[model samples]
Every structure is written in C-alpha cells, then in structure tokens.
Target: MGEKFPEIQGGGSLILAWQVRNKKVLVIGGGEVAAGRILNLLNADAKVVLISPRDGLNSEVAHRIERKQVEYYDRKFEPSDLDDPAITMVLTAIDEPDASTQIWKLCKEKRIAANIADVPPECDFYFGSVHRDGPLQIMVSTNGNGPKMANIVRRRIAANLPPNIGDAIAKVGALRRKLRVVAPGTEEGPKRMQWMSKVCLKWSLEDLCEMEEQDMDELLQSYAPDQIPSLSQVRLGEEPGTWQFDGSFGWACVV
Candidate 1:
C-alpha cells in the first residue's frame, strides 16, 4: 500500500560528538552547501569553525562568525588546517578529490571523523538534509546519491506537519504523565498507547472545545481492561484441560 525505503544507518551513531551541546565542529570550505550543513550543526548547538580560501562565503555566515557565534578562517587549505585538536569532525567541501583524500588520511591519523562532500566512499558519514522540532528531528538522506531527492522528500514530510504539532505533542506529554498516575497498576504500556491512539482518533473527529467532560470520562473508563476468567480455574473440576501457557513476561495466556 505504501512505498518502502531502505533502512537508515547511523540511527544511534552517538550523534553527540563530544559535548556537542556546546562543542566545536569544523567546516572546511565556504559556499551555500557548506552554509546549509553548518546551519544544521549549529541548530544542534555545536560551535562551528568555517574556513574559506576566498571571498565566496555567505554574508550571513561571515557576520555570525565575526560576532563570535562561529569562528572563521580566511585562508587557503594547509596541512595544519586539520590540526584542530578540539574539533570533533571535519566536513570538507573543497570540490577536489586529491585534497579530500589527503584530508581523509589526515583525519584517520588524527582519529577524527570526516565527511567528504559528494564522496561517500571517502566519507565517514554523509550529511542529510533535516528538519527538526523539539525532541524530534526528521532526516532525509539518499546515502550520497542525489540530495535533491532527499530535499524533496523532506519538504513533502514537512508539509504534513503543521505548526500546532508541537503544542499537540506537549498536550500528549501532559496526558501521558496523567495516565501514568491515573492508571498505574491496571494497564500495560502497549494497552495504554492504544488507549491514547483511540482517544486521539476520536478527538480528531470532534471539536475539542465542545468535548463534554462526561463523554471524555466515559471514553477513558472504557479503556480499562476487563477481567477475563482464568482458564486454569475454569476447568478445575473437569479433566483440568491441558493448560498451555505462552509466557509473555508475567502476561501469560493459558491456551
């Protein structure tokens, strides 16, 4: 019914490179492409270092670096450009294979992660165009094969998410905490999630402002699991029908 995509790599690749909340990330080369990557890293709260050989740097980027929000180096690439011991990763967009190769070798010797633009084989990681929200980020990547397609997919997904999604998520968080308190011992996690799903489904169909308290209470109460008769007890006096248990971590069902 829907198109399937390849499994994503680096899902939990310890995205935090050092103390990323306030740490250093060095971006070599300057252009619109480098600007985009640096922006995303900055959003993750990484302190950025951008070095450009010439004057092609974006004005906004230069301004931020000048203001000390980011650091900029206006010089040609040198062997020492890769000598930032504090740098966690180096993203090179110099548009040259020999330079990228040399840089990769240097990074390897230094034990630093490096990404070469448009060169997956030489890159330790590939940059993905991403859109982020609080505690949630959507990354679209084509594994270094057509970032244009990735951008298209990202925009398509972005369109489906509206501005109110954040507020709705906050509301859900509040409801989840309330549920944990209200239904502590009576429900399992899966069942609780299902109950929340049903509530959201119903809420989607009605005007929340007009929702009645009695109706909401009735819906919540209905989510409580009804006690079922124990199978072992049912055949106590009979042949004691073969009670086979499918162990489910304290949730066994006798069949």
Candidate 2:
C-alpha cells in the first residue's frame, strides 16, 4: 500500500486585538448581521453609526436605537458616509449585493477595512468568537470558513481555563513591576523574563493567587539577592523612572 499525506488547508489570516475604543465604526443595513456587529462595537466602546431604512431592524437593535444608545440614520447608505474622517471601519449587511459591493468599493478607496455579511471576498476582516476573563481574552477564528466551530472551540477553551487565572496574571504583573524597580540593570530584562518563566512552570494557579507582596519580595531576595538592590536601598519616594530599550536588546533606566 502507498503512503498517503494529509491535505493542507490555506487562507488563514493573522488575527489581532484592535484598539477600537473611541474610534468611529459604520454599519449599513438593519438585519441580524448588523445587529451583532453593532453590539460588539458598543461593547468595545467604539462609536457606532448605523445607516439603514430603520424598518427591518432586529428587535434588540431597535430597542437600543429607541434608547438612543446607537446613532441611527434612517436612510439608505450613501457614498458620502465614507467621507467622514472619523470612520475607521465599515460593515455592510444589506440584502442587495450591488449595494454591498458599492459600499465595499467606497471603503477601499477611503482606505477603510470593510466586512460584508455572508460575503467573505468582500470582507477585509472577519469576526472571531471571543472569550474574555477580565484582562485575559481569547479569540478563535476559522478564517471566515466555520464560525460555529470557532465558537465551539472558544467555549471549550474558556471552560478549561482556571477561574483564578486572571488573578494569577495580575499578581505576576505586580511582581514584574517591583522587579523592574529593584533590579534596573542591563541584564535585568532577560533575567526577569527567565525568572518569570520558571515561576510559571513551578507555581500552580492557586499558588500564584495566594502569593502576597511580602512573599514576592522575599522570593526575589532569595532567588537573586546579588542582582536586586535591597528594599532599604530603593528610594521610597522617588519614581522608578522610564525604561528605554537599547539597540543591543538590553534596557537602560533613565531617571
């Protein structure tokens, strides 16, 4: 029998966490697709502007419009809508293919990314199913191929994560800040990163959550007493000052 090779899939996209806060997002049409995207933008604190006939809006979206939570323009979309400099991204969910295509073309000319519902070719980006735990967020995507599968994976991953994972991360972040202040030297960057990696490998989630500041200080003294300055040596009232990255992959502290 001949050996068989598994088939490889293509068209994967680079996913990123966009800082859409205070940015203007435009949506065309008033159906379920538009409603979902609008809600997501609102959650991110993005200023959303919806242009539609206002007759066929989803019930929840209509309720939001009634409450004036979203800026709604009850009219067909016009090319002039893209002229607004505040508009960063556009989403089109109109039933008419011609209208969606026109909006997408205009967005291209305006250098704005656009997403057209049920039309992958017309989209500059695709929405992913996201799971969030405080500052921790996980996004799963199938390159606009299988959204339901992405949602399933996201739910599974969210369920598997420790409930106190966010707290653990926060504790580690605090420890890192203290390390930077007490151990500001050329070699401190790599040493700190290596120490953090060891900490993650050695400590459990519960251990991290229960770690106190005093314990962290004690641990630092025990681990690298020679590298870190004594607590009494650090000026209590003075700021730690800014850290600048040297071209040689080291950090220089500028007071």
TM-scores of the candidates are 0.61, 0.72
lDDT per residue for candidate 1 within 139-182, as digits (tens), equals 77787778899899999998887555544444445555666666
Candidate 1, residue 248: lDDT:
21
Ten residues in sequence with the least summed lDDT for candidate 2: 246-255
Which regions of candidate 2 deviate over 4 angstroms? 1-9, 66-69, 174-188, 211-255
Model 1 spans with C-alpha error above 4 angstroms: 1-19, 170-255
State which candidate has the highest lDDT: 2
Give the per-residue lDDT digits (tens) of candidate 2, residues 136-177.
778999888889999999999999878887787788788878
TM for candidate 2 is 0.72
In Å, residue 141's CA in model 1 sits off its true spot by: 1.4
Clashing pairs in 1: none
* Candidate 2 pairs with clashing backbones: none
Task: Report how far residue 196 has shifted in candidate 2, in Å.
Answer: 2.8
